[model samples]
Target: MDYLLAILIIVYVALMILVGYIAWKHTSNSEDYLVAGRQSNSYIMALSYGATFISTAAIVGFGGLAGTNGLGILWLVFLNIAVGIFIAFVIFGKPTRKMGQYLNALTFPEFLSKRFNSKFIQYFSGLLIFLTMPIYAASVLIGAARFVETTINIDFNLAILILAIIIGFYVIFGGIKGVMYTDALQGTIMFLGMLILLISIYSMLGGVTHAHELLSSMAPLFPESAKVTGATGWTTFPTTGSPFWWNLVSSIILGVGIGAIAQPQLAVRFMTVKSNKELNRAVLVGGIFIFVTTFTAYVVGALSNVYFYQTTGQIAIQAAGGNVDKIIPTFINSAMPKWFTYIFLLTLLSAAMSTISTQFHVQGSSIAHDVYCAIKNRSSLRITRIGILIAIIIAVVLAYILPGNIVATGTSIFFGICAVAFLPVYLCALFWKRTTKLGAIAGIVSGTVSSLFCLLFTYKKVAAGLGICKFLTGKAVLFSGMPWPYVDPMVIALPIAFIFTIGVSLLTKNSKEEEIAIEKMFKAEEGA
Candidate 1:
């Protein structure tokens, strides 16, 4: 089995290299590297968007959360389809595409900077993405590597390096074209593999109804760690207003769901397509893709409890040795056929590769295109490639250092920060013509500072994990309250950002030059 898996992995790597080589041949300039030359079809756009949006973090990290938290985590599935896909495509996609084309913007930060006519906004947003995105990228790396470590019994550190090297090869050379072309292929593999895993799980546990009934009956066995925070059971929602509920709702569901709109990597996908027509066509594909993938992950994660209890008389978390990140991987390896484990490994690889490649690309472009190029007034593909290399190295190091069972928490932290820092400014850029450069800058700064403060001082899980709060305040968290510790930073910071953005914009008038730029940005809308 080891020899077979090795041969299969080699074949997969060779195929990816071929795809990357093809993309490399076509990528002659920065535009092609950054936005796929704005020539992507609906199928490619939708699949790439879906593939990049749903990573191993969703499958392994949040899936394990489902195993621990139960079916309540399924709220994220509805939001993934409704907000992440439908609203993002229908509401945000058209305007972003139009304005990006109008400005000839190659990146998300550039789009906003051009809209607001602020080099500061561009460099600051770029810097934020470059500095913070490694946390999210590292989570994806850990998710894939954890599965590899569990499935093949390989050293965890070695698996992380191997996955990073494979993904870095294509992204550093092939760029967005390579990322998207390969994403389409990988997305399809992920979809099929998940579909099979879903079916096999249901079939293994008798049928859908019986399997669900079994899970529901086993609710009494909810973990004590979760119960101490007011968990009622696995099948039902946590006690309302409980720490568990706040963590589930604010940090996990809303953080990732609403935050998806402002992610630089995913937002950049809107500019890959040519028109609203392609985005419109993509909505259905993207929606179904997200639904199938996320729904399966959550449901299977929840049902794993039943399988584990029946086989080993232990709950999902216990069977996986108390690591939430290991629930799905352990379940798959222990319960499923050996052949399916191979397929699932490919699924995880595709998930991790598609996401991390895009992440590194965005991070690289943030530095080389948005920050460095904006400062130097020049574009260098060599510098962008180098930036990508540096970003990959940082993420790899983070993967090595981050603690266990951190996949879901790390994902939410980055997503929440992006929401607080970028979402207000992003929305204002697209919709509100009255927004000034000062207002946008104010929003970004306030949102970023407040969010970091909350993470370091207020949010118990994060502050305690980092130990910075304890070092300074002599407490796990500065706040000694129920919801305060559990409340996500986005909850506190996003509203503050919106108020600053609107109030400041209303108070300070746009300059003559800024007014002209704003008008140009909204000219299409005004004409319509």
Candidate 2:
């Protein structure tokens, strides 16, 4: 790591702090803090949305995932654009914006609680967000710091703390305006860095034709373990019933695709826009952003393996650090020019920071605005700042103690949990006419408990790694289980929650209060 390069990176961090300082002026209330006063234009909205959604999980996890999974991982980029961005803006964005406006709800929990009529739903959902988001945030911290420490040679713990403090305080002070403004800027860095990396790699490998030909000839670059796992070659395409295929099709694509529609962090962007037309405008920009950035990232992640194989005849299996997580950084250090590697480090740091800030922000307000404020009737910036502080502390602790693939696993668990606990009650609040409060409560409990139980007792890595699952389930249930498969727990739990909600609702007659709530939703929606 050159001194000049390290200085350059540190300067960028300072500039980000300055941006957050600027955002402090814009936020005066809960609305401003949470959703930028609901006035972000399409460009800001789209870029910010894209940056936040493309977290360290996408770069660190997905890039390494590509090394092992091969071209098959390309499926994720398509899903991100189509389901994560495009349809998210079209289908989910519109309704979320309309209802958020009608209910004056700033957080997802607030939206669901206001839409339905349950305090338990609001507080419990907030608890879930607060609990899981830190694990995700810690993962983001770990990813950003790992790259910085390796590329620049900073201590691991020091880098993690510095990054966390900067992001935490910036978000705590600047709120949504700061988050979006910086995200848009970071999105540009990510795009340009990837562009440079791809062009350089292909050019170095003797152009596209030579590179592809060399890569294709080495079909055995992929190990036999991949085939048993149900994958073709990483350089080639996917095969049938492979874990890779099931993971791509069933878990990654379908799980995240359907799940993105319900993501609170992204959904808030719809509320931030000034009008439906702005959201409509955002789809084009968002589509282009996703296409370019994600396209470049997936391309780089997949093809880096090709580059490695052709150059060293050694597979991507931890030649440098012995961990898959280091694959991209190792590639940058070895394959890319020093200047570009520096920029790529910034690119990754920015991506990780952008998403971590949002996660922390969302987690804080879920506690402050949705759970605490709804009960306590407090919404001061000071109270929100305290909430942010508490959330950051928890996340920071997690960052130090244990973190690997934390963001990815946390995402699977978080999204799965949200899908189960929030999805059924949320949709009912918006569209269903006959949903009862009893049903909503039943759904929340069943979904949350079921998902936790599955993640604990059934997911082998999660259970064995934590050891608490072993204690609760004892040896038999722990050792005998098939382990949570490719499908996130949401796959099973969501349906059960919906069933529990609907079955109970159908059995019970709607109270006049429930009728009035439905009528109000329709009336407000029609007028809007």
Candidate 3:
């Protein structure tokens, strides 16, 4: 079994390397490296987009949450399909693509900086991304590394190092083209692997109806701490207005759902394709892809409770030693066929690599292409490669040290920060002509500061454990005023940022050149 699994992994990795080599040979310029020369097809773009967005966070982090919280996680699935894929593509994709071409924008920070003609916007945004994105990237690394360690029975730190180096090799050499090519292949694996796992879980439990029925009947086993947080059961939504509900609705769902709009990696994909039409076509495929992968993972995660209860006389969380993040991996190891366990490990690897590669690429672009290049007034491909390596090293170290359940914590931090810091400015830059450079700067500063403050003073995770917060406050959280232990900054910072942007913009005036650029952006044709 070990030999067979090793063979499968070697073959899969070899394919990835071959694809990277091909992409490296074709990467003759920065454009090809950054945006795949803006010539990707709808299929490749769609799969790549979905794969990058739905990483181990979806499969492992949120899947574990479903094991504890129940079917209510489906609300996130609905939001992903509706807002993430459909609205993102139809409402934001076209204008972004057209304007990206109009302004010669390559990265998200570059797009904003060029849009409003603000060097501060460009530099600050790039610096923020470079600084904060490692948390999210590290989370993805931790998720995949956890599975790799458990499945291969190796030292956890060594597993993380191995995974990071492999990912960095391809991303540093292949650029965006290699990343997307691998993403397409990885996305297919994730979709198929998830489908099979879901089917097998249901078959083991009789069927979907029986499986859910059994799960629903186990509500009495719900945890007491979960009860205080408003958890009704694994089969129902937490009590509205309860701490759990707030954590679920405010932190997880709203943080991630609305946050998707501002994700630097995903947003960059809009500039990768040739036309808005390609983005439009991608919506359908992406929607289906997200649904299949996320839905199956959530459903199977919750149902795994029944399987564990029947087999081990314990629930999913208990069987996995009380770590929610370990629930899915444990189930795969103990409950599934040996052959399928190897397959699912690849799927998890696919999820991790697809997402991490994008993170590394975007981080590299943030520092090298956007910050350094803009300041130096030249694009050095070598600098970007070096940036990629630096980003990988930082993320790998963080992955080794991050707390348990790093997936959820890391994902929430980055998503919440992006929603608060970037979404308002990005949205206004794309749609609101009156959005001045000052307004954008004000929004960015207020958003980032407000979110970080709230995270340090209000959220328990960062407030209590983050040494800086504890040193300054002498407590986990400075203020105990929050109704819940966990409330994402988006609930507060996002609104503040949005209102501040509008108010500041209304009070300020755009320069003549800025006005002309905004007008040109609004009226520009594709490839103009």
Best by lDDT: 1
244: Cα error in model 2, Å = 4.9
Candidate 2, residues 152-268: lDDT per residue as tens digits? 889989988888888987898998888998898888887777677778877887887876676566666567766766677766666665555656665555666567666777777
TM-score of each: 0.98, 0.93, 0.98
Ranking by TM-score: 1, 3, 2
Alpha-carbon RMSD to native, per candidate: 1.2, 2.5, 1.4
Q: What's the true lDDT of residue 158 in model 3?
A: 89
Kindly indicate the candidate among 2 and 3 with the higher lDDT.
3
Estimate, for each residue in 179-212, the C-alpha lDDT of model 3 and write its tens digit: 9999999999999999899889889899888888
Error of 2 at 249 (Å): 4.0
Q: lDDT for model 1, please.
A: 0.92
> lDDT tens digits, residues 1-528, model 1?
478898988898999999999999999999999999999999999999999999999999999999988899999999999999999999999889888988889999999898888999999999999999999999999999999999998899999998888889999999999999999999999999999999999999999999999998987788777798989887889899999999999999999999998999999999999778999999999999999999999999999999999999999989999899999999999999998899999999999999999999999899989998889998888889999999999999999998898899888988998999999999999998899888999999999999999999999888888899899879999888677999999999999999999999999998898787678668865453
Global lDDT of each candidate? 0.92, 0.76, 0.88
Give the clashing pairs for model 1.
Answer: none
Using TM-score, give the best candidate's number.
1
Which residues of candidate 1, in runs, are more than 4 Å off?
Answer: 1-3, 525-528
